[model samples]
Target: MTSMPVESPPKRATLRQRVFRALSGEYFWLYLLLLPSILILIAVILIPMLFAFQMSLGNTSIVVVAGRGSINNQWVGLQNYLSLLQNPSFWQALRETLYFWVVSILIEITVGIGMAALMNQSFFGRRIFRVIVFIPWAIPTVVNAMLWGMIFDGNNFGALNDLLLQWHLIQSPIVWLNPSALFPQIPWLSNALSYLGSNLAMNSIIVGDEWKTLPIVAILVLAGMQTIPHEFYEAARVEGASAWRQFRQITLPLIAPVLTVVLILRTMQLMRAFTLIFTLEQFGLPVLSIQAYQQAFAFGSFGMGSAVSFLIGLIALIIAYFYIKRLYREEL
Candidate 1:
């Protein structure tokens, strides 16, 4: 028998050859397609966030010197954060922001689910009704704020005041935007729960925000509802399940993931609510976002503003994390 020649080991791929192979691979096109978006995100979001964080750690106030202005970004090392923690106004703003977020989110979720359930049903002109429901959300935030402002105007000619006057609900026109305790008659209760005191201003803001935002929640919930199989409802009906029971047992559990997403999104949006509140009340109500705006623009305290913004972002992240964790726990 003839001895077979030993096979030579294949040469290792050079670094350049490996790189070339990767560049020519199936995923190369996908990475190339994503490059522009990644670059844009880095330019628009990541860079600004880094700059803001740096600013938060230092004083970035502009100082004028001999007809020339220069940014005084002297490192203060968490002084801005420390000062915000020590400030009573900061705490008050945080409380107001949380109050607004909680109240508005509760109302939105409840009303939105109801509206979604209604729209999910088959009825005459259901499409038209859905369109009408969505119209408020389609309206721009600034426009919505201005429209509500007119309705809630303190003047006698305001829409609400006029209606109330016609109905003989009050003897005089009410200043709807006034920041007064909701229950001044119950001083103890008012003192105990100052944050929830039904201030007309805050309530009006909530109403406007809800009117514009509720439709979004409804739409989202409706989308979630659509994903539920009609067979589920059919099976429930076969078991003689009532409408409420069907909803509670089948609809809710199935759509929980969607609701969790909605909660996270709405919480972030409500926490950063500035345009609607600012347009409606300006600096009248001190919410966290407005406080940040005032610190940056009104008071020229960019460092403080950045710190507040960073805090808001951190809070949003924490809330989102909790929501996601709970969702996973429920799934398990």
Candidate 2:
């Protein structure tokens, strides 16, 4: 009897065959789907970023002249960065930017978390209240800044001073816009604290910015709160857990991730804060963005401005990397 002929095993797919299969499969569809976004990002973000890096490496004058499109610039590698590092104004601006970022984000998180907790409760008109809280956020940044400027007007026309005077809060209308009176003295503190009163102008801007952006943090936190299962709270309650205990044990840990996200986002936003501060009080208080603007446009030192901008960008990247690492560690 003739035995059944043995069948040969199927050959392994060649590299070209695998590539052909992938091109005809789900991966190809995904690549097609992502093509438009990738192209747009290259055109809008990547190309400009590369060009800006090139500009930062050279002394590109930003001055606009009729019939002249651009100024001739000489390549001077790292000179702009070195100059910015040694510049007193750059240091001052960097300090002020960090101060604003830290102070504003702290206030925002504190107030935002409080508001989120309050809003999460079942209350009449809660929806309406949420909308009201977001009104400043809904308004354009320019309008928000302008509105605050009007309210903080140092003269009789100022609404804040008007209310304060009506309530007998201040002896006289305070000069809110005066750079000389920007920071108030902390009489109890010594040395640098006393000198740090010069930050009142920046502080005022910080307050305005916090008002506009606090709702964003609150909303994010509220979303986080929603993700927490009610059963967890119910179980804790059944276990005789106090409200504070429940929050500390259950709520805080769950919400910490969202808070980290809020912190990173707020830090980035405040680091590059421009429109509000520029509109409300231009050059009165210097932050990094304002400094970059002054260097690039005011003095036509595009290279130095670009260097400062890139430095701030570097800081943002570092912070983002740190938090992302923390996020991964927490997951582990």
Candidate 3:
């Protein structure tokens, strides 16, 4: 029996058809609208990122000891990465950076959620209080760092020191900025913790960085909190639930999604906390971004700087990928 010839699957769309489909669909206009943005992003971000990766592989004249005047594009072939791996200072800096990032982000999330809850509640002058709390978030990181830097000005005349002294908290003006001046000679920016001590001098300065950044986390949480409905709280209240109970049952689950998104976003953001760290320079505290800057700019080691930058960007990309992945999963 002659079977009917099998119908071939419809011919696959050409590159042109694929392009047309992407450009003509509901979001196709959006794609068209966003084409420029994507192009710009590639041009401004991706290109530089790739170029930095290439630089990381080469020994730039800036960092290496070379003979005669010339751009030293020596193809070192992973020596830079090897040197980075072997360097004790790099490890120390990495340790310090990890500690700083983890601690600050944990505090920011906790405080951010608390602040968001407070803002979501009914209170007198809530608007004003929110404005005040949000002021820091609105301020530029450089400005916030500058402001805090002045407050901890390593002098008695600094705002915080002045206030503390005025309150009779101390008979003498303590140099807050000086590492060697802490009660037990706690190192501030001038030294690293010698051994694993529960309390380190670097902790004091990191608090400044935390203060400057926590408000940003809080603002993001507040935006999340606002999306939650009041009906859930009201429903819980109708059942004679305790405030804590209401929070646990009603607020927690409802804001969990927001919390997740905010956590990831803020995690990525805090990871790139370079500007604040740079401005609040205490040589003792070497966070990743600060280390990158010092390597590239101070030492003029472009290859090393490129390596540092490449690693940072790699981190940011991973976080972003996971963030978007979770978001997609939730949506589905």
TM-score: which candidate is best? 1
Q: Please give the CA lDDT of all the candidate structures.
A: 0.90, 0.83, 0.71
Instruction: Report the lDDT tens digits of candidate 1 across residue range 184-303.
Output: 789887765565434768888898899999999999999999999999999999999999999999998888899999999999998899998899778989889999999999999899
TM-score of 2: 0.88
> Candidate 1, which ten residues in sequence have the lowest lDDT sum?
191-200
TM accuracy, model 3: 0.80
Model 2 pairs whose backbones collide = 182-200, 183-197, 183-200
Model 3 spans with C-alpha error above 4 angstroms = 1-8, 14-17, 24-28, 62-72, 179-201, 316-332
The number of the candidate with the highest lDDT is 1
lDDT of candidate 3 over 1-332, digit per residue (tens): 99999989999999998888877888777887888999999999999887778788987755234554644667887888888879987776666665666677678777777888888788999989978986766777788778877887767888877998899998876655443423355455224443322123346556877776677667777777778788877887888999989877776666667777776766666655676556666455565667777777888788887887667667767866876787667557
Candidate 1's C-alpha lDDT? Answer: 0.90
Ranking by lDDT: 1, 2, 3
lDDT by residue (287-322, candidate 2, tens digit) is: 899888998889888887888899999988788888
Candidate 2: segments with Cα more than 4 A from true spot: 1-24, 62-68, 180-191, 194-198
What is the lDDT, from 0 to 100, of the residue 258 in candidate 3? 73
Question: lDDT (0-100) at residue 134 of candidate 1?
Answer: 90
Superposed on all Cα atoms, the candidates' RMSDs to the truth, in angstroms, are 4.2, 4.3, 4.6
The CA-based lDDT of model 2 is what? 0.83
